[model samples]
Target: MATPPYPPPPPYVPQPPANRLGGKHKTVLGCGGLLFTFVLIGAIGSACSPTGSETTKKVPGPAVTVTVTATATVTPAANAAAGSPKRAQESAPAPAASAEPVTAKARLSNHVGQQLQAAQDAAQAEGFLVLTSHDATGGNRMQVWDRNWKVCSQSPGPGTLDTATTIDFGAVKLEEACP
Candidate 1:
């Protein structure tokens, strides 16, 4: 082949552009992208997070107090002889003694040797809760039936004058086979 024109212009080789971004500029862009991704993820997570609807707010005005009083009215008798003292006396009801609310306190009682149901009933009647424990020390287990179980001992023994709301009872089968 004869020298082709300009000797094929010495194979063209590609070169990087002179105005390309520097290393520092690339690093700054990468960091900014990562920060934007993290912020976006955090915002989405917070939007989807579980939260309660109720908001606690303080009242703006002074607290108001209210008092209520009750009154009793007597109804006149319809079939009595016109203006009769006997009728008036019979129609008027006697005034009730000052009514006061009564609260019953639990009085620890001797429940040992008593049936579990009876003990529980007695305790509940006195406004107390009952906690029963099995006494299965000697290979004897408590039965599911309350009546079949007998209390062997009690905590805070009878007449202690302590207002414990809950009384614990140690019980076993009624056969008395267990110590």
Candidate 2:
């Protein structure tokens, strides 16, 4: 091999102290490390928290009582025999004890501008059954599996004392504007 004209350059060595990080860089690195540690701790704490599947026992509240009174009616034929006390007593039946009311009246809440499932849940929570009506005129077909419909209007507007056990909801697809 032919010898080179110039001698080979000295081996390069990095000066450690020349490129050392400054006070600002150290401060930034420390802050980033602390932030990362806090974030990691927060994530771990969230992971350890109870999820939906975990249930806690609830303490029950005091019981409520309702009183009702029942009245009995006597027919004319039975009353006619009232002249004979024994006969009248035998003919007339004993009055039954009053029972709790068949249905409870609840104030209905307006479900307008709410999602269908949320509306249904709210109604049902107040002891009312939900009856949903879908608007298909907008070219969208309603399906049982789809719950993304929004309620446009509700029957028995908000704060109405509802005697009926069922409440009606008029709903349309989420993409459609309310009527």
Candidate 3:
């Protein structure tokens, strides 16, 4: 066999693509995703804030701390008949002595069949500041998420209650039936 003057060309081999997207395209997409995440987070934070104010202002004056204090007085029923409701009276607010829950008169609303969070909101709206809940079935389960629980029963159901009173709510999981 005679040797060729030039070496034979290497056999043709297929090569997979290095990348479906270029570095520049990947970077752009990553940046877009990051920006979207930041915008989402900011929107959630702004929406969840307690107040609608977008910014806070600094006043050049003596810093004063405001405290809310209240007291509730329930008068005995004029008619000592059974099932009669007593009236609640509000006295002058006293100075804040401690971190104890303020005792004010808050009307209690019927919270049965409502979400725990809604129940709490309603109680607060009714002027009841202090509120709490427990497992209605005596399962000893704690309500970790207020929105996931439903109010089965409430203490001192639907009446004028003292703000200082700890409204006890018996709640069950949203999927569970109230006992």
Candidate 4:
């Protein structure tokens, strides 16, 4: 038999091109890379997060009457790691028991010209906890951050008073003087 000039056109085969990448493949690959990048960033961020600590004050004991202040720092290897917190415990001497009822009184701290937070801390240290403060300029502003304000004047002045008295402090911003 005589051969045809084009070999019958290789039986008219229809095959797709091998070198070109399709749009669908590109889209799928791009989405997978983006997802991988986001997951890697989240892992790195979680590793750099801060560890935490907590402060606890004064626990009453049955016989010892001990005053304890405990503080602990927590660290997590993974997310909320299963372990005990590192703690520091402190103790103070307790007074002897007595039958007589003791009256409660606190000598007020000289909080004038002092930072509002410091004044509050000092007063609380002296067994006075019922406290209130107001703007001395009649602005009726709230002292959101006590450290930013100063005590211009305090009620009942600085003297020993009953613990029941609600101590009120008149305060102004650190930049302004009392009126």
Would you estimate the TM-scores of all the predictions?
0.36, 0.46, 0.47, 0.44
- What does candidate 3's lDDT look like per residue over 52-107, in tens digits? 32222222222223368655554444453444443211232334444555344645
What ranking emerges by TM-score with the best candidate at the front? 3, 2, 4, 1
Which stretches in model 2 have alpha-carbon errors above 4 Å? 1-67, 73-92, 96-102, 136-140, 163-165
What is candidate 3's CA lDDT for residue 143? 87
Model 2 worst lDDT run, 10 consecutive residues: 54-63
Off by over 4 Å in 3: 5-7, 14-103
lDDT of 2: 0.64
* Deviation of model 1 at 22, angstroms: 91
TM-score of candidate 4 against the unseen true structure: 0.44
lDDT string for model 4 (63-121, tens) is 21224444444333332233433321112123344445445665675677777777787
Model 3 lDDT-worst window of ten? 54-63
- How many Å off is the CA of 3 in candidate 2? 67
Cα lDDT for residue 147, candidate 1: 66
Candidate 2 colliding pairs: none
